[model samples]
Target chain A: MDRRDFLRLGSAAFTTATFFPQLSFAGTLPHGWLNGFKDNQGRYGVAYIDQKLQAEVLFHTPLRLHGIYKHPTRDLIVAPARRPDTELYVFDVTTKSIKVITADEGRHFYGHGQFNQDGTLYFTTENAYDEERGMVGVYDVTQGFKRIAEWSSGGIGPHQMRLYKNRLIIANGGILTHPDTGRATLNMDDMAPNLTYIDITTGQITQQFSLSEDLQHLSIRHIDVDDNGIVYMGLQDQVKNRRDLPLVWKTNGDTLDMMDEPVEGWEIFNGYIGSVSTNTHGLCVASPRGGCAHIWDQTGTTYIKQKDVCGVSKNADGSFILTSGEGIVRDLDGQNQRHALHFDNHCQAV
Target chain B: MKRFFLFSFLLLSPIAVQAAPSMQEMSLKVTEEFILPAYDDFAKQAHAQSELWGETCDAEKLKPAFQKTSDAWAKVQHINFGPITSLLRRDRLYHWPERRNSISKSINKSLADKDPASLDLDKFASTSVALQGLPALERLLYSDGLLDGDFACKLGHTIALNIEKIATGTDKDWQEALVNIKEGIAHPIYFESMDEVAIRFFTEMLAGFQMITDQKIALPLSSSLKKANGKRAEGWRSNRSTRYIQQNSLALMAMAKPFMSFMPDDVEKQVVAQFTVFARAANALPLSIKDGVKDEEGRAKIKKFLDETRTTRNLLVQTFTKHLGLTVGFNSLDGD
Candidate 1:
């Protein structure tokens, strides 16, 4: 379709009342979403889509946000600044005001957080730059998101996280980096990335599973849990030429299983996975670098090629909604829907 | 020389730093001068090599033709985005540092069976990507000094023909992309902003530099010179690893040239000086990069060249990108 047509469709797709009726969800789904977006003018914002499926800027951020977390019980959404940016904004939909939480000196948010099931406490991935260690900064949500405690994230660059039962699963990316140097990866050769499950109540590590020795350089950075409680993780290989390494893995809290991908389509993933989603149907991984989305089930896998596509979250009907930096939104079947803002990365379905 | 240096210093001083060209101008110029010409030249050379292959079966006669095509490819190899990538021509033309023995093995098996269909360009394009481009031709021409038969020559000819067809198609695709940019119409997803476009261009150039330094030099030379593995270097199958660096650096220099024209005089001169030194070293290297990595002095020279390129890259990031008002995006690799 032409640009004008796309613009019209985009506006119509988000036109408050009319949009929801067109959705297969029928406006009945209780949960909607929160995501990070950069507009055409390079401004960053945390956007919210309520139960009506209407999307708008809830609040603006100074820098790009990599991850957005919603409190399980509260009407609050916490957006941590991307790497090297210490600003974190906590916005309450009910109040329409945001409170800023700054990381302690030398500590920066890794752009991911997860709250306990009851929303009493919150866990954030942080980097202790000076010490070259990763820390999970714990906050008591009952007391104004206060910084109350901290725990080791079990690896160097802890990124995305998912709460499973009472345990928090952190994807410790393993590559060493310092905020002082500004995003330059320090230890690629000796990177030992792993999937660490920590007991949130006691702030103690429960278990960790790592990729095999040859595949250690695949930085396990993003994670999500399926309906069956299977943790699916996404990885980006630190080494560029190792195109054959697996970018998606499944774990049962004991062993990591890599889904078999056809070599031709796998190489197009460009040794990185942009985002991953798991719904009642199956698992989907987005590859903006490779310009494709990989969907897999127990029987087979399919790759849907779309340029700059990254943000992916499950729709109410179990289908996946994919967003791109191009200001376009599409479903897994190549159906182009519209959103007004350019999607930055992860699209979280709350 | 002293007077010229003084003039450059005044122009580059913070007080006199001039405004760079708009991102639109930068994009148009790069597309016209660097990208289009590089792809055009490769298409011509690949077609010519294919014709030469059809005329003779002698290894000596065909080797130079193959080298010309491969050399042409190295110039445009860094243009891995847009049309070339969409067509899968980037990997189809040269799946390097991945196993090339597979290409050799596939070609030999086809030749042994007198695979008549292998001579068809359409058929070959559908075949394994490894057997479709320069790496395949390199194997057919250089592996064990050219296999002994007319079928081998036919296979090489077909591969060259396939590359010519692919390159010509790629040139057309790029021309369309350039048109979209010039017209401010969005045909590709990355046309969100001129700043975004500039960032993409700079990122690719930076990635090219990274490949030359990290993959070509550092990985092979991991730990120390003594522990370096020559086989790990790019283009090792054809002993053109050094040549790969030289050509890749030159292309990167060409892409960065437009930015240089817009920079303050002193910064431009400094960057050019470093680039000149690096290019000279690159050109003066031994033909076979693998052999160069085997010795101490040679290894030192290569390392120094790598360092110079890194310095030039930094100047581009810190000075030119800032002057142009281009902002680099986070998560180029690990997206989510």
Candidate 2:
């Protein structure tokens, strides 16, 4: 089939098999998972996988998305375009429609964001590219998600933030890039990555923690917090030929410490952790380059081998749902479900 | 008798499925034919240079030796994983794209100190990586009057020895890695499967092309002729920047040959033809990369060559990923 026909068939399948049923809105919204994905025909979109594993493509766009976020108390989901791109898609579950959120002039989304407890305000990690600054863009959810205000992220490339009490914890990935160069890090020789926490109300920096000088090249990219208020980070080493560097770190709001390396060594992850998620059991970090998911708990570190695995989230029962670019969704029970969609970097259990 | 028969049957069984055998063959060929020999040659040339520097620190005699060692490095430098990645050996061998005058500053610091104890092999290895690599030697030899002093000559010899040590260690590590691959042992630092090995080689090949196009060519070429910076070119001091591209293209071709069997005949032919075109164009470039980027015609020629390199890389990415069924993960390939 031609490319158009293939995409048409995909949309038809989506409408018939998944979209129609979801549009009824008869009972309470079903529990589902949200992730950005690229279909077999190379179309980028966000998919909502229902409990039965039926994925409904809320919308497709030309921009590739990275992190998928769901509204706190509403049927709204947002998929931010990956860095160097200018658009973010906000999908309304009840209406089955999507609204485009454009980054302000001279700014672009870093593909991650979070909603406040009441969902009145939304915050996104963004890059003020022209100034080489990281920004936390606050949106007025009550005003049609308009760009309300922006705060300095306390470092360069801020990615993957989490809300803890009144603080917005940001992983300031120190690599500096301009859209002109298209994600090429300009300051690799001296990049200073830090974990910065800002007050949600005032956008003032509450605290910031940085790695030692030797480990300055480790970009603090992804963050997660457990029930104990301990924060975890997934790092991407900016330097090449660094095999022994740590990829996961944890903080107790005071000091940042590297986690113990898996018995197999850090080289297996190829120095990149695509996603980090925490559960009641413990922490799970996905390494897409390494094609493995590592779990750390009281039982020590163990890994599940799956090719191209990246997006990982905690299921309701505390078990992890792992997705991959190879279009496989795997659970801790060893069950594998195949799909025609290539899952992107981050997923959320909505 | 029945137990013995069952054991024999199990031993004779072929565990690899259809794609696995091709991947296994590709990995084995790449390891045995290309990676091992390339590194072995580098180690040999480095050791020879070190011995020559020890015998006589004359610039004339050592310059030829340095070029030989550098060329040998150009062949195997694309293999960035496994043993070469350990101990910062790769950067210690040739720290290029030296930012903020790091190499110059480090070299001057060492010269000012002039302490013999610091030149000891182990102590030197622990020193700044910039001073322990080929670039330091290049600066010492190619720059006028820099090596005339006794301490500077000794330092050059020490850098040669350091390169030799790193090259030898990397070669030995690759040998052990090959053994692990052959025995099907799950090496934590290297490969747990033949598929993984193939992917590593493929990734390196793509990265090699990218390095050539982006760093080797475009960095020096810059945007326009007026903005061209010759010193930005790698190996600009030795005037072998263009030669490095040719050598890298040839080495990548050698590494890519084993995977051709896994692709269709047309794809195999296209890849071969494209590599041949790119290699010839790269080899035929008359001026050094340092000189070539200075003028409009030269810049045009280099730009055409860069386009060809990118085309070749895209072809390889399309064909290799498709035929090998390798999902170059979106997140893994370019994750934010």
Candidate 3:
């Protein structure tokens, strides 16, 4: 299809009316299917989470809004200040106003922004978008908007971040290369790419491992590490082969050694891994309809595909609040697949 | 030197601060969807379906038999990442409309067990199954999904299939299967290809199988494919596209030795076909060809075996097929 036609069709703005029937596809699941929420066939120009899906005009932005975190100390949702900066946005969920913090840092944003156990420190990654910019970073979430204890994206597209006590696992999905253009999406093939680790306090390069074979396409987008220290990242493999990219990798905490690697084209996508998080012992990653959600365990590696699912987050009651381009959730896991919280625009989550 | 140091320091600072080291083995979020008891379960079942074709006296029996096989293929789609798979993987397992899975399985089994010298009526009937469904790729592009491609998948298939007809046909018809395979193997050489059906479907399908097992990564062979390509320089491979090209090459290689070893006629011509398939697969490797590389070493070993088959015949075929089996790797039998 031509770009004009695609933009015309894809930019229709996600809507509940457009998606209500989609949720019925996986009707057996208590939480609605994620595929039901995605544009499914959209060309992926920009993505947004309409609070209208859950509420009316709560907060809105046009940064293609990747990662947004709920503030711990106050009523705020902290998303990347923008796609290209450490610019963190502190938006009030209650008041419906937003502040772009870290605006001074001109780095490109990926997603998955969060605070340390103390809630005082914030961590996230930004792509250099190639060497034109520096990669991702880890900063402190302060009373005044600021990015502290920052870092580079390593290669070109350093994406999300995970904080583990003295250590941090960066989900650096190299997303710079464009498939249609047939160029280095991340312009990282000239350099090495991998999960780079450093001791938070010492700021030393503890160790790094590269998805050496496929170059920069092994974008480590989102991450979740268990108590045992095994790390996982939602991968968007660069190439479009059944055998490469759009994968997930795992590593042991203590050794920082890789326990799992992405199967080239092993999953349903060749796109970005949006948001990945864990509740209790369970973990999930969004393939952006690269498609669906993979919920797995740390110890035995038990996994379940909440097929066509996304926005997997833990609710206050130990349940999940899954947001889709369509609005749906598996509030209690009973499998009704009901459309919850109606909306008129694209619906992601806070 | 001072200026370089300053540049490097500024460059390294954020990477040092913002980036957290990644774990070498990340437990993937979606691998759970792909856990299945087998990777080729549908293929296996399809093989079974192929065997049962026309065995019964009743047509009712025949339809159900085909339906059962078709059902398995349907399940495979639900498991596969995307709605459509490339013709190559599709070829590995046949699919028919009415009773595809079963009928294809019947053909494969009969062929696998058939002896040319003792061939019978049953063998011909079972092995006669054809590819049925939404027309092959060539038709899709020119007819439906595409507008501007030099050729689509079916055009390629038709060329190969016609070549086979010419080589193997009776004195008047002039049709043959081996000839078809050879030309098909060489087609890419003449054409500078553009796009291919992406592999997201493969990953998603594999992930679906993995889900049943709920494992970290979907397929065991993933590690091997990654490891094989890992050591090479990124260069042109930095582009995300090369994955499909690499897989296409590997799939062709798997067919190379079998085509050669199974050669029925002039040793020279048969060896030529075998070499062609092997070379095509190798040339398609995504990395720019390099000397003194490990890939070169492996290719050399396979090529040597292919060449040896010219004189040694059966020994080379066994050796090559064994190699193909090893290279493709294994998945759980359940499609997991």
Candidate 4:
């Protein structure tokens, strides 16, 4: 390399070095390195995926909202909130107004609530920070917030619940992992796993299941059900003492299941797969932190990723539309230009 | 050998401070640029997205899984650092558009010419450097004291510096840095074509990164993950290690780019289409597995007890059919 070549190489080396800065002292999670947040942003509000970002601020406080349920026919948006207050905010999108929904003064939630297929009744999972007393409350989908049903998660903390007809398929993410602290700080070894299938109207545990081993620490939090009766769920593992696990699993509500181990290439990126949805082809899991859509065979078989993909939604068109980490909504058909959106409140499709 | 080189460039001038006799040159240049401030209608949209993804985030508590991969690689960087570092550089740098494009174009060009030196990873070619001396400019721009002249500016400073550094590619060694930088950007670029998952997943992408060397990936993927069965659930399986394959496989594809003229259209369409479809499905996978599962067994004697409840999603038949229909073109199965 001559002088000009020297300048170019020197510049290149410097760029490489600066761009790929050495990980200094892994020192207990460099909060400094993490910035440029998408999919969700700005004050306390509810985020949803649409043609672009549609942010409607419910509360002015710092409490983080967890759930946003759309009224089946009405343009009403139901948003469940946590911390500071356990209030659920209801908004009429067409009118662009708001209302608050809640269970009681004592309970707040770590997850969300959903409307019935008819949009008459709604269900929200409440953690209450007390595992023994944790419950899922039912409210009037429309009028005055009426409390109907409240059930238990056994031991697992229920953050998300998917209503499969009468069967409320809930992901009881066993332990309560804090958002204030990072993932490396939870204990999973002593966890108790149980998947309770309750007939929403009856509130009876018809069928129960377990992983049968060392994964009790795995929190069954998010779930998706297809046209078939198959319940596709997702998990979050508790980091015990000083260790963490990023392995994902799948089963057709059976004890015998396939653990979708991270690809040999992704062991280190043992991604926390979040939110699962299945198309005609296979299942798609979001590694929110990893920023990629890890698509695996329906049986938890093969993991083929579109990498760094996030906030996926079945588009108005038959294909799926997902938000990229770069705040672009890319069509599955591979269109020339993505419908670029951002969270002016928070960007990207959520 | 771990080498360190630090050369500071002189961007500021001493003559400006020394030169006396200052003139009252208060001439103003006003440019009314199109301005739709973020605080306008975008705030609500931004907030809605955060809560929506956050509420929906954690399909599988992936941070634990994602962190595990990064943790292991961090431990191994003490040795060959090739694959691991390549992955780290990819994640850390690719987040920037210019850096990402530059890295991709450089790699693409290098692959075309087969000459790695064409990459331009300049440390100083940046927007951040121009903004550094903006304290004086700040007092002039916003007519003073009206905007946050402290913390936000500091944050802007950090973002600029970070992006510039990423643009320069100066933080890591340059042995195979070209390929490393390209792969770093490409992996995410491929996977993240859709939604920006939650924060926890980003950590996993970083952690799940594995070191793929030329010799190792020469074999590419061993067996279809679906093919592995009961006994396949052994040693390496449980660990759920993530890999960074497809560099050479992709490079090989890039080389065949021009030669693709000879092949039929469906063949080419099926190839890219299948890979992308596979990529989409792969992207949604692990998080589904991680969040889709639960350990209610309490981790003790829960293993001996078994529960079998079957609920199959029939739509999957179509997905599998699509997989079968597409020509994946993996060399692992030759006899067929």
lDDT of candidate 3 over A1-350, digit per residue (tens): 34464344334433101111011112121221111111223211122222222221223233334445555555545656334334455654344445555434334455456566766766666544324443435565565455555665454455556667777656555444322111223232232346767566665656666765433445565666666666766655333323333366577544333324333234434344555666666666654444355555455443333333445665444444555433344443543232322211112233
List runs of model 1 lying over 4 Å from the truth: A1-221, A235-350, B1-20, B188-197, B280-287, B333-336
RMSD of each: 12.7, 7.1, 22.6, 28.7
For residue A39, what is the lDDT in candidate 1? Answer: 56
Chain A of candidate 3 gets a TM-score of 0.65
Compose the digit string of candidate 3's lDDT tens values, residues B140-240. 22233321222222222232232222212211111121132223322221111110111222233333322211110111111122222232321112221
| lDDT at residue B78 of model 2 (Cα atoms) | 73
Model 4 CA deviation exceeding 4 Å by range: A1-41, A44-63, A82-85, A131-133, A177-187, A240-246, A259-269, A297-308, A316-318, A336-350, B1-336
Categorize the docking of model 1: incorrect
B1-336: candidate 1 lDDT, tens digit per residue = 232223223324454445667887777777788888989999898888888877887767888887788788888776656667655666678765444256667776787788887677777887877678787787777778455777777777788788888899988887778877787566643355555466567777878877776566664554346556776667777677887888888988988887677777787888888788878878866666677778887777876776677787777777765566654433343354
Real contacts retained, model 2: 0.29
Backbone clashes in model 1, listed as residue pairs: none
How much is B229 displaced in model 4, in angstroms?
41
Candidate 2 lDDT over A191-211, as tens digits, reads 789999999989999899998
Model 2 chain B: ten consecutive residues of lowest lDDT: B1-10
Task: State candidate 2's DockQ.
Answer: 0.23
What's the lDDT for candidate 3? Answer: 0.37
User: How much DockQ does model 4 earn?
Assistant: 0.01
Q: Which scores greater on DockQ, model 2 or model 3?
A: 2
Give the DockQ-based CAPRI class for model 3: incorrect
TM-score of chain B of each: 0.87, 0.91, 0.23, 0.21
Each candidate's interface RMSD: 16.1, 13.0, 21.7, 23.8
Off by over 4 Å in 3: A1-57, A81-87, A93-97, A128-133, A136-143, A147-149, A177-191, A212-216, A244-246, A253-274, A288-290, A298-308, A315-321, A335-350, B1-336
- Residue A114 lDDT, candidate 1, scale 0-100: 86
